[model samples]
Target: MAGTIALPLEEFIASLDNASLPKILQVCSGVYFQGSVYEISGSEVCFSTGDLIKVIRIELLSVSCEDVRKNDKFELPINHTGLFKVVPDEMPYSSIEELLSLRPVGLESSLPFTFSSHSKMTFGTLTLGPGRALTVLSIERHKGEEDQVRCHVKGQQEASAEVRIPLSSRGEFYECGSEECFTLQEIMSSPSLRSRRFHFINTTKYEQPLVLSPVYQVHAIMNLRKNVLKFPSNLEVDVVDVTEQCKDADFVNPLSLTEVLSQPDESFPAVVEILECPETRSLFKCSWLPELNKNQHLVFHKKGTTAMVLLSSLKSRKTQQYFLVSQQYGGRLRRRPREFNSVYELYAASTRTPGLKVSVTRNCEEVEEEGLPALSVGDQLEIVSCTRMELLCESSKGNKQSVEALLCQHLSDPNDVDDDDDDDDDGDEEVKEQDEKTEVLLPLYMQGHFVEILSDNKKYRLSDLEKEFSLPLDVKVVSRDTGLELDPLVGAACLRIEASMLEPTIQASFPHRPDYCFEIPTQWLSLSVSFTKHPLPWPQGQPPKCNIERVTEVTDVFFYEFRIRGNTDEAPPPRPPKRDLSSLSVTKKSSKSEKKSSKTSKAKNKQKSVPTDQFSALTLNNKKRPPAPPPPDGLNDEPPPLAPRKLSEAETATRKAQPNTYVKMEQSIKNDLYDMSADVDSDHDYESMDESLVSMVKTAQEHIVFY
Candidate 1:
């Protein structure tokens, strides 16, 4: 400390070379420009006196040129290719040795450099007149002889001669401007040349002599600050080299997660302080994320890159969620049937899985004009292919239009097994008839509820499914990961495989839970920490076998972002064509025609008898009262008198068997209402009432009379 000197911050920084680093400097004076704090790059820098700064690195940014006469300053890049000539010093030298010592470069490199003398000089039979120039070509030395400079001289009539001058020769020698040139880099590289004045070779623009100085971007760390500070060396502050005195000074060196990856392996298994907390708390749903606070201590177990698969919860009316599952997940997955709300969705699913079979969840009415066949609840449909179909009914303009439709086969229920072996030939003929009648055409514009019918019950591993099936496949987690303290996917009903990615993460944990580690994805989360000297929580040579958290919850935004980055799937199927509602026309029948049709239907019903068996096949039986017959053809066109509606034998027999079944009248009314609602064609038919509803009303009246 006694031999240390306090130099201006700029001078001390310029004198430093990378090989001699890293030097510690004490701020002898505060940085002030016009009595105010100096700022660089929007950071207010006010280093207090006595503050210690460890100068870790210095980078040569550019060369600063200052005009001596005008006091003007500007900067030139270190790679500037312009040439410059050294300006001669106004003061004279006393000896040849003194003149050679002041050369910008080494004496050998400055050979053939010309100079002149103000007075005449006689050197042992050699005479040099005033204002005569001599070029020192080289230096010569002999045994037991003083060093001498070999000079090349030219006089009147272009006559030239060579001579040697002793090193100790004395005269009023002055340095003369030379025709030789040097670049900005060459001048700045030489320690002695940096102090000399130079002028541009092309004097047209920069005629004035300029003094060149090196400007360095100093990279240092203040003891109070956690991050490294970068500032130019031309600050108006003074510093002293205190590295030797404060050799034990401790500085907090904070490094980002990305920077930590570059550290040596020995740096791990050590405690570290969190300097900057992670800013992306919303991206990850983890308990440790909130605990990652500033100044919190965590033990970094190790770092590694892990293969992860991104799973997303099936999107519904609720918010869609995402999860990151490590490839090491031990849980088993079972394929879950996907649900569709429209024919277009079913078509899209068929593209991914051929021979896709689905069951109707809601009944759909037939639209003959639009080529939409009727669909009843519990009906199974096997999507065969896409084709064009012509509607059964023509448009209002009497023209038939072809539309795109899905061709599907209606599979009969398995419960409808036949037991008639004696009539096998008849049953075979009936089966063929049913097959031909089962082909249905569904237009893409129709909306219906359907659910996928999955037949495979085999369980598959998460990784196996990801490899075997293309993503966006739905699955349910049948088993939970035992390693995790809380697995979010354990009870999830359905999850979709969004994508797979290889993530580089840092395995870290809290000091209290050194053996329980959570990964910090270096690419996703931004954090900064300082490795501490604190000993590991565990004993030496006995590191804890950390249990890493493999599953983490992420937001839908992360899923969409990942999709954007890595999505390579083909474009989605083209949208279905819009339906033209204006083209559909419904024909209204006249009163006379409606009456004739009603009579004909009633007569046909009378010809068939209802089965008396109690165990009858279950079917969608929708019974409606027949409309009153219109006036006879020759009778007056007057409204008919209201009369009691006639009932079929099935209804009569049911009533007789349950004469005291009035207690069940309410339940029978409910059943009748449900059956009527299920009739798709009865949506607009208000004239007809279910026969059971009428019977329930009559039975209630009769019970009132008896009571």
Candidate 2:
């Protein structure tokens, strides 16, 4: 693979060793030289090739072949060796002779070398490297007149192996050059080298002058097998189908098959984003046809300009009318290299299939009724005028005849029609004939016509006109050209539907009032109530009474006498269905009902316990009551009933007596504890006194005559 070697001028020069003394190197810029580096000075590098001496600045010697391994295998340097194809350059060549006259020029010498041509083709064997060479056969053509006569390398075959070459001017002249064209712009600026081909010739001596043979001409060559430098190269563009994930890309709106045919002239924004490698490149803005099954072609163009055009069409089977259009961006030019403005337009007719006409505009105007030009599918027409008309004539015939016929009909004669079955058959036949005559001869008019209806807008039908006139209408033919309203009947008049109905009156019941309205009916209003604990001695007065405040009333407070029906019961008004309460219950329904009953009983007991109009003070005593004995064993199973809140006078006295007995028992226990403590103190004192008397007697006897 051929590639680019980019490094500092000094480092590339430093990679050279004794064995790699004879090497081809390039300067950074400002000078062109492809010679062996003879000597390296502090600020200069010298190059020579027998009678040729080129001294380059140290800074200018930027690019060099540093690959110096003797045993390393090297493939073709695709970038340097013009062994690739040559495509039509932006510069146009008119004839085959002009294109074939192109010659390869050296960067340093600007020396021109022409290819040896035979049978209108330049055939040469390219020596790729040592023991590796291929024959390059190319031809020039004056095809595609836009950029005429392109140079193309037809093919490459092993030089040692025999391969046949066709001499005829036919088949595809492989497209090249546009993408494979190589230049030495990176290393040098002046005396640029560009060739139509390249061949490598291995020389043992550095001073040997490079020459070409009658079979092969050297465009440019690098001995990669003996260089330490490896250049980066681009792989050939591989055309593959877009991945299944990208088949329906999320970013781009592809043209559907129906849209391609129906909306041929419409231009849709072509935006596609590849989510897989999103950061690598910006959005791909290119036109696409959804109807085309082929995926987008991805080209990796490292250098130069590229342009792509795709044409797609759809045709009608019966009419042979089609929508032919080509979508593409302008090819890259010096002024606009990467153009984003893609152009697409429908063709007047299909060039591929004869007799196929393409329609660009969708609006088809009437030629007969509007007195416009007759237009075929591909005819171009411009809008003259557009206006709104309440009534549009449907039939091509004149409108005056239809209006006159309507006015002649007698609307009052329907009541006198025959009711007999025998006459019905005759009447039907007469009605059918009259209908056919009116349809075939007179112009039919559409009274109501509009794309959209806005507020306060109105449309009227024929039925409305009949209803306005009670008797049969007697219209005198009025000329719109003269701007006259002529009617023969005395009470006859013309009136618009909007004029007759000043304001629309709907017959349905009133809708719910808006939230902003304060006068919303009481039934429409939602009321909520909350209860709070009242303070003690709450507004002491004669009696507590509930009061109702009259906030607002629509009518004067009217006192109406009501006669209640004693036999019938008024049905309750419907209520909104309540939310399910089953989830709220912790226990089963049976247990829940028992709990509710118990709560209700407790509420009743509490109400009865308190005096309705009086306050009862609570008094607590400090005396402790005697602990009650444990309930009998079997009685423990049943819980004791709660005592009444208010106790009778006798029961209260008895309860009070129970506390007195407990106090007495407590006092007796304290007296017995005191008596025991006194007896223990008296015994302890008597023992001590007795011990003291004995000690005193012992001391007196011991002092007298114990000796």
Candidate 3:
């Protein structure tokens, strides 16, 4: 989302630097320990942390730190000297007496500190603990005070040797404990600067000098003539180059968005190609002046100027004033800089209290004049009288004015009257009573299905159900079937329209879509309704109706009853008993047996109804076997197992005795057995002799034997 805005590259970099550096410093400040320098090179400086020496690159200081200075130096006790960072507002002091009397409250380091011209010398008071502080100072001098010094040395022979000390060393400048003095430039340039002996601890606290990389060197170009710095002049060129490289990119100027909005009728929308700032870095919205060459460097007028003005004379107000500053640029009122002001303002001529300017921007025009008072809803006001054109009103403090001049005013209620002048207070009581009776109807979410049966007998189902249910049943069912409807589902109930009601006066919101509202009539399609709650007072002789809305999201599949305000007077419909597998299986098997018995009965009925003459000759065939036909005509019944007659002669005798009727019956029995096994859920063997089909086959075989 941030990529959608066309922010300048420097602005983006500045934002990143502001966000990242503070977080890094916060984290480092908590854990950074005092360390001594171990090594220094062109790229990085390594500092010893007792256990390890961490190397910090010189490039990091310029990239992260905003205030970077160069060639500044400081000193410490025990003859230690090194270069230190300098603050932006550093000043030079020549007298130590002025430094000792200075307070350190507003200083960045919260300590007594001073620096010489160009920050060449820095004096600091380090508070090690209560009552224990170290005062260290540094100085820069070109020439040494002493001229030439002579020293005499004698070599030791047998007994003793004597050495002569210089008399110039005891001069006035070498008195007290401050005897030693060295030129600052000489000390900072010596070999001892790289000896790793001095601990320049406070250098990291101040503004470290910048080491500019090639790409970032453009930022170093600032206005040096005014002892100040501004944004780089070539920034506009870089922006144009980048835009040309990415021609398809969106060109949105966040600063000039308001300008674009103000100029809607222009042929082409205005786009800000460059953003310039002064040395203070106070950015403002600006545009290029006319008739300027491409590379001639155009100057801009101060865009918007804001000021904090105070109004000291307005009545009954204590808050300060804020103004939206506009400037007269090129003889026209142009918009001001897009800076935020925290003052709360009504932006009306009536609200401001006119007074002297508390603090004004360099040149800003006041947009609103001051005279009128802001009127609110509950304020008290007295109406004087109405003229031919406008009405007049007076304030409580006796301020009189025309009502037209006021920005806002409240109208007095018609029922209100002066209590001191009125004899009776009955009107007020009547007004209060009317207010109490005025009821606002809210939406009611309801869902319900028709009640089918009153008794718990499974004999009743949806087929015998009524279209609607009401508290009183005998009332002529005003609803008619109209030959337009059919019975509902097997056991489900239909919507009971006759028992439901809706409010006539109030509009009900749609259950599925709360946004859609409509007024429900007192009676629709001549449906009957009865309310169990208290009777509603009717206005203008209108009948009372139900105030309800149905939640269609609650489908009719589940039996739902609306319960409101902890009232559970009506219970939900009872659920049917669930069928167990054992009972289901038993019933299924019994049904099959009953079907078989019915089939048998049907066959018996057919046999009894058949003409006797059709099968009169078959009666003898059906009779019990006449002693096996007298042993097949005198041959012994078993004829001593007469040589198995030729297979064809035996088949002929059997076919002649029993005709195709018996053959058909046997084939039917076999088919029935196969079908019975196939109809079961699991695998079954029809060949195995067992229940109904097996018994039927055995009976048929016995009948064949008898024949």
Candidate 4:
């Protein structure tokens, strides 16, 4: 990912200052309040300097008594002074003149700062000494103005005080260059008359004068000589320093960069340097001069001139532009670049290399050493060491093949092989390996998980169960699942490729994570927000996810009983059954005898196959059988038996057991109910469906039972 290229100062500014351009970056917040300052760590420039992200200021002027003295009109009865925050978006159409004509809003003491936040803010405390406080008094007619309440000020002081704090602490200025130590003498030169100067001073919105460029010297020297006018001297000319904030300033001259570079004045001479493109064939090294000129005013500076032009032919899918720069020390007798006037262009450009270890983009974006250029499906290219032009490779496919070959050259390292990158690979300890531009503690947000479950119908255990129950019960689960795919954890559900038609019930709750305030552990607490934003013309989930099963009744319950007190633990008292299960069964067995029983209640009834009951209940009073052994081969079965059944008389007649016996038979029938009924809207027979991992409640309203 290492590369280099030059960019003209003017073009460089344009590229970096795109208002909507979002860069992967981090910043130390610079705002403060209370005894502490708020330092920002986000990449968003929500507020900077005096830009007023959203701060309000209001000042009250004049009182009713002052107006009474002038117009003999007494509107307010007493004290008067209003100052408070006004909502930024709510500026009234009328002026303060009209506003004052109406009744006052409220007392100043009750007025609070316009904005507030729970998280400690980091910012500078713009200090204003009490001497700067502005207080105006008038005998007026108003409730609070009358001092009838005298609550805003202590000691019932008659004088009211109003304070307006300035945004900055000092009004300082620096020279355009390092000649800050120049005396009045050096500033007053005669030959060139006056030198253009800069003034960074600020004064209360009022126009102030400090001799921005020493006009006195220019006037004096102009009166003294004629050659001074002919000298054409430009002093410490505020040559837009392409190296600092000045580079981004819009006031610089367009030709200034060209003037600073040395170029040949003779026949177009060309000097070349090799530019390596990860994908395409290297392009020819352009000369800086009139050689590439195809027009009058413009010239293609290919060597070390600033890069403002992008050659489309030289571009790859992964890159938007690449500059061809000319050499720095060029002259008329040296290389001359031909003129180019396409909407996009490539030209010679120069810029100093930044000293930081961070990797920089040669002709496109700045990237890290390990960064890889995003490549299209099939692209091939190679870097020509001799020519410096990135040449595209031609596969059997031809042109598109060439495009594909160039794209392949974008790989981060030509010599390296690929292996799945580890998750914890960041050069920094706090940032995770795969988490790009994201802080580690953000999702767990001080350590916690965000949970959401998908269901066709909204049904789930809101909390994890701690106790197991015999009868099916409606429950809520609060289980702690493993970390989800990182994207959904920190973003909205729409980001999940698995997002689908199923409605998802999402709740943000925290799991166990240490809280820190300074070095001390605070509460294990985290804040969460939730709401659903349905996708428009929503796309279906990926990989064909399973449909959510509908749940109606919960037939049983499960729960756990425990209490926490710091590190101490306590066992909760056992709960009771909703209804007694002793009366429902036709056959019965003693509790004592049941202890020795070996027949599984399920298999026992399967074998006995008693006659169907006339009435049904939640817990059968029927004889309890030995517990069913595990399925012989370790398979799982569900939903215990429903009710007893009786044998038919025909079956009894066929039976030759010890004595003749008669048994009742239940009618048997089969039907394609779903197809025949047309609107059955049913899938599995609820009563006979196999038990699921979770249980459901029965629907008989009269069968009073507890979960």
Best by TM-score: 1
* lDDT against the true structure, each candidate: 0.80, 0.25, 0.26, 0.21
Off by over 4 Å in 3: 1-109, 112-257, 262-654, 657-707
**Residues 323-409, model 1: lDDT tens digits:** 988988888889988889988888888987888999999998886656667889999899999998775433335556677788999
- lDDT at residue 72 of model 4 (Cα atoms): 34
Report how far residue 115 has shifted in candidate 1, in Å.
Answer: 31
Candidate 3: global Cα-lDDT? 0.26
Which is the better candidate, 3 or 4, if ranked by lDDT?
3
Model 4 reaches what TM-score against the true structure? 0.11
| RMSD of candidates 1 onward, in order | 19.5, 42.4, 34.0, 37.9
Q: Which candidate achieves the best lDDT against the true structure?
A: 1
Off by over 4 Å in 2: 1-193, 196-425, 440-707
Tens digits of lDDT, candidate 3, 1-707: 13234433333332332223211100011121234221222222221212211111111122111223444433233223533222122333334333322422222232323222222221133111212112232222236542321212222363322222122222111001122233323323333311111212345554343321111211211111111112221121211112223334322221222332233343121112223222211111111112112212211111221211110111133322111111110111111111112111111111222210111112222211112123222322221221211212222233333212212123344445556745557876666556534321100111111111122222211112222221111111123322212211111111221122212222223222323322222111121111112222234345333322212111121112212222446533222222345656888999999999999999877755653432343344665432321111212333222223335876877764443334444555555555555665645432333455346545545454331
lDDT of 2 at 447: 16
Worst 10 residues of 1 by lDDT: 611-620
Estimate, for each residue in 1-707, the C-alpha lDDT of model 2 and write its tens digit.
Answer: 11134343333433323343233333323222344332222223332221111111122212222222332223322134322223333354343334334433331232111222322332356312222212233332345532222222223462243322333423222212332323333223322122222222343322221111111111111222111112211111111112232323222222222222233222211111111111211111112112112222111101111111111111224221111111111111111001111001011111211222122222334433322222223222111121222222434233411121100111122333456766478776687456433311111121111111112223322234334432111121122211112211112122111111111110111112111111111121221111112221223332222111101111111101011211237433222222225533544676889999999999877855643211111112324433433332223355433333567898988785332222333334344434444666454321122334334433433333211
